[model samples]
Structures are given as structure tokens and as C-alpha cells.
Target chain A: MRQLIVFTLAILVSTTFKVYSQEIRIVNYDQLDKLVSSTKDSVVVVNFWATTCKPCLEELPYFAEAGKVNKNEPVKFLFVSMDFTSKKEKAAEVFSKYNLPGKCVLLSENPNNWINKFNPQWGGDIPYTFLQDKKGNRTHYPKTFATSEELINLIKKELIKQ
Target chain B: MKHLLAILFLFIVSISIAQTTGYKPGDKAIDFSLKNIDGKNVSLKNYNDAKGYIVVFTCNHCPYAKAYESRIEELNQKYASKGYPVIAINPNDPVAYPEDSYENMQKNAAEKHFTFPYLLDETQNVAKTYGALKTPHVYILKKVNNELIVKYVGAIDDNTESAKDVKKKYAENALNELLQDKTVKEPETKAIGCGIKWKKN
Candidate 1:
């Protein structure tokens, strides 16, 4: 009886871990747009990154650290992986490796259709960051963050505006 | 006074953001003389019989560029005879990415069997003037009355991951339309790609 109970517990743990690791959602452009624009009473930090981009890999940890530091604040982090839909598993693996504090989604659609919708000024560069305050004022940073402090500071500034 | 200063700062930021300073469709593109992998300077004027050029700002390192390498080669094969030869330019700073160095570019082209002239934008001035911000950025120019008119600007296609999955061949469609003497319906497009590495001042 005890052996069966132990086996059941192990299965539960493994299944939960599997589910958590595969939690990276694959979203189309419209779904991503809704997710970003529909956030209520919170500052949204949407980071565009790819597994193949070197600078993106280098700076992801900073965003993850920033997310942890601002856990108490009303800021939400959304990692938008620009990886090909075929490489969704690799993207999920990278996302899990960071132990990121918020949701990670693979944006599976032609960027040509929606890049201007996010920011016409953005020339489709990865490591791009889009920040929105509670009132919907948006800021675009088309470069990598040097540290978690830089990200946290930006979030703080946005929070105070509300 | 603080509020006034803030407003002034915002205005400056907006101005910087809005400054595009790049070529748009119908704009006449300037010809450039850049060093090709063959150690010879290649100028658009050299191609007297050509109808136009497919100026691709690509590099050795970017995966998005690599993914479309074969397609770019195919474009050169399919259109070079028809007069629109692909002129690939590596625009990244080698100091930031050693993989984008001229030596590696030669190796990449050799390995990929690229028929196009892979040039190095050594000063990066050409890329800046054309307003190319990312690797794999493309500007299709049409020769009209001795001037190179910018016809299309953007990605090679709608899909970057799989060539077989591509539904809209953006660059090829523009080329076809140009060949048929029709106005390109979609003049511009955008795609997520590796940002071109610029030299630090």
C-alpha cells in the first residue's frame, strides 16, 4: 500500500514539473496584442528576444532578476520569443532556464503584419523592449539592458506615473 | 519650470524617434562602390545591362539571414539572367561580431555556394544611408531612366522559420510585379531580425 502511494506521489510531481516547463504559450499576433493592451492597473514590460540572438541571451537574466525584485509591484513581465514556431520547444527550454518570474510566449506569425502595430519606429530588432504604464503611455527601447537595476528603475518610474 | 523642462525633453525624444531619414518607395537610391569578396570594388554602374538590383543587407552570423541563405541564392539564380542580380552586403561591425568579418563572409558565401557578390559595407555608411536596422533587411531597387528607384523594402517573405511554410513571397512578388510592369501593391514590410551591430563611437 505504501509503495503504491509513493508511486502515485512521484507521478504527480513529475506531471506537474512537465506542465510547468511546457507553460510557454504559443500566441499569434492578435492574441499577443490583446494580452499587452488588456493588462489592467499594471505596468507591462514586453521584451522581444530570440534564442539565436547573442545579445538577447546575454541580457535575459537581467530581466528575470528585475522581475523577481519587483514581485511586489504591479509590474508584469512578458517575454516574447521571436523563435520560429518549429523551435517552440527550444524557446520553452530557454525560458525555463532563466527561471523567469512571468509568462513567456512564442509569437508565431509573420512579423510584417504586426510590427507597425506595436511601434512603427521599431525596425523589427530583437532585444527590443516595450514598456507601458498604467495609463497606456508607451516607451520603446531598441537595445539590451545592461543590468537588472536599469529594468527595475524603468519599472519604478512607470509605476510612479500612475 | 520642471514641467516645462519635461515637456522639452519629451519633444526631443519624440523627434529622435520619428526621424526616419531612410529611403522610401519611389525615392531614388544612390549607387555605391563597396569591396566585394573578390577583392574588387563593385559598383552598380558596372552592371550596365541590369534592370535593377536586390540590395540585401545580410551577415554571416545572424540565423535569420542564414535561414534565408538558400532563398537568396535562388533569387540570384532566378533573376540574375533576367537582370536583377542580388548584391549582398554585410553591414555589421566586426568588432561587435567577429563572425561578420570579411574573412568569415567569404567562407560563408563559399560554403553556401552563393552566386551573388557578397560585399562588405566597411564604413557602414551605405547601410545607415539606406536606413537598414537589421540583418536580412532587403531593398529592391528598379532602374528607371538611369536612376535606381526604391521599389520594395523589407523581409524576403512572410515566414522566416521554414521556407516550405512560407505563404507570401514578399520579395519575389515585388520582383515579379516589377518585371510585369505593375505597381507593387505592398511597397514595404517589416520582420523580426537580428539588429545590425554598429561600431561604438
Candidate 2:
């Protein structure tokens, strides 16, 4: 029984490590929108960023920290990269360097044709974020960057409302 | 002290008044004297022979800006003889993006063989006052009654990724309309671009 318990623990540890070191996925805007809209019972925090955007790069650690602290909570943080399809590898390298939490998706679309569709308030700028409850209600934060405390409060506020 | 306060209040009032809606169509554009790549000051006032100006806020590193660099040059080549000239400005802070520095600006201009005046808004005051939110932002200004009036604002065209596939030429159309003595039907547009690199205070 002790051996069996040890075996089970080892399996769990291996799986967790595998997940931690997993490579991020590259997804188009349609696939991203579908995944984000399908999540249930969670407060979704979606951040639009790019590898070249200095402010976006600087603010990822805050989101990662918030996600780590709220690992067990019904809060989801998704990073939607605005990098090109050809730069998928570069974007992945940046994401791995930061070890950002949750799923990071690369939006391989012409931003010119798609900026307004994300939100009318979006001025096609990076570091734009959106907070949403399980009910699909959304709040847009069209700023350059946000703090972990600000993100936590936003998530908590949305969770409470749910 | 009272005199100082009065001057301060007037300064604040003038700034607020000049920044009204930020150069919408029919609004008079604020002229600026910024340093050009040739190490000389240039301004709308200096373009005495120009009928209009394509004031583009762009930089060296932003992909969108790079994509439009040739097109902007083409704009000046195509229209400057017709009395409209392209005036490009780099508003990005060099501290945030070193590739957008003044030296790089000169290198990019040299490599691209830019005919237009590529200027530097080192303080970024012009960008802020114009309410420019992103790189590659365009403001088409027309000369009317000895004043430069903003005729169109926004993207150069509808497509940033592919110039050939573009269906609408927003800035070009506006200029063409102005040349024909007609008002622009679509005076504004928004395109995806790198946000301006602002200096950290």
C-alpha cells in the first residue's frame, strides 16, 4: 500500500512538472475567441500583448504572479499575443522566459482588420486587457500596463458578482 | 505672484483650447518647428509652396510603420509636385526603444531614400497635443486661406499587412477630395500599430 501511494505521488509530480514546462499554443483570433468565450464558472482576464512591446513585456510578471496566487480560484488568466504568425517561435521564447501562467495564445491575424472587433474602445494598442465573468459580461481596460493588485481586485470583484 | 498666476492660468487655458478634439476635420492645425533629419528645423510655415501636408507619426522599429515607409515616400513623390508633401515624425522615446533613436532615424531615411522631411518630436509634445495614440498615425492637412486646416486623420490606408489588397486609401482619398474642392466622406480611420513609447517620468 505504501509503494502504491509513493507511485501515485510520483505520477502526480511528473504530470505537474510536465504541465509547468509545456510550450504555449499558437492560435488565431477565432480559435482564441472561442476558447475564451467557452470558459465557465471563472472570471476571465484576457491581456493583449506583443513580444516587441516593452510595457507589455514588463507587465507579464504581475499577471503571472496573480495567476500563481489564484491557482485554485475560479479565475482564468489568458495572454493573447499580438505577434505575427511567422514569429510564433520568438513569442514562445519570450513566454517561456517569463513562465507565464495559464494558457498563452498567439493571435496570427492582420491586426488592421481585427482591432475594432475585439472592442470598440480598443485603439489597436498593446497591453490592452479585458475582464469578464462566467456570464460573458466584460470590462475593458485599455491601458498600457496594470499591477498585480489591480488585476487581483478586478478578478475578486468579478468573482463576487458571480 | 499674482502676475505669475495670471500667466499660468492663461497658459493652461490656451493649451486646453488648442487641444480641442485634437485636429478634427475643419480644425486649424497647430504649426510646429521640429528638427529634421538634415539637421535643420522645418515647419508647416516653411512649406510655402505646399498645398497640403501628410503629417505622419511613425518610427523606425514598429512593423506597421516600416510597412508604410515606402508608401509614405511614394506619397511625397506622387503628390509633392502637386503641392502636397509628406512630413514624417518619430515620437517614440529612444530610452524605451533604442532602435528608434535619432541615429537610426537617419540610417533608415538614408536606406529608404526618403524624399520627405523625416522629423523628430524629441519631447513628444506634438504627438500628445495631436492626440496621436499609435505609431503610423496620419493627419492630412490642407492649406486654406493662409492657414493649415486638418482635413483627415487616421491610418494611411485600410490594410497594413498588404498594400496591394487594400480596398480603401483613407489618407490619399482625403487628399484627392480636398484637391477637388470637396469634403472628405470618410475623414477618420483606425489601424493596428505599436503604441507610442512614452518617456517614464
Candidate with maximal TM-score: 1
The top-ranked prediction according to DockQ is: 1
TM-score of each: 0.90, 0.82
What TM-score applies to chain A of candidate 1? 0.87
TM-score (C-alpha) between model 1 and the true structure: 0.90
| DockQ scores of all models, one per candidate | 0.76, 0.42
Candidate 2 lDDT, tens digit per residue, A2-80? 9999999999999998865555577766888888899988889998888877788888988888888788888988888
lDDT tens digits, residue span B1-201, model 1: 999999999999876653454778888899999999989999999999999999999998998999999999999999989989999999999998999999998899899889999999999989988988898999999999999999999999988889998999999999999999999999899998899888778
Q: Can you tell me the CAPRI class of model 1?
A: medium
Over the stretch B1-201, how does candidate 2's per-residue lDDT look in tens digits?
A: 999999999999988866544566777788899999999999898988989888999999998788888889988988889888999999999998999999999999999999899999999989988878788999998888888888888889876767887788888888888888898998877777788878877
Error in Å for residue B111 of model 2: 2.2
Each prediction's fraction of true contacts recovered:
0.95, 0.58
Candidate 2 regions with alpha-carbon error over 4 angstroms: A1-34, A108-114, B1-21
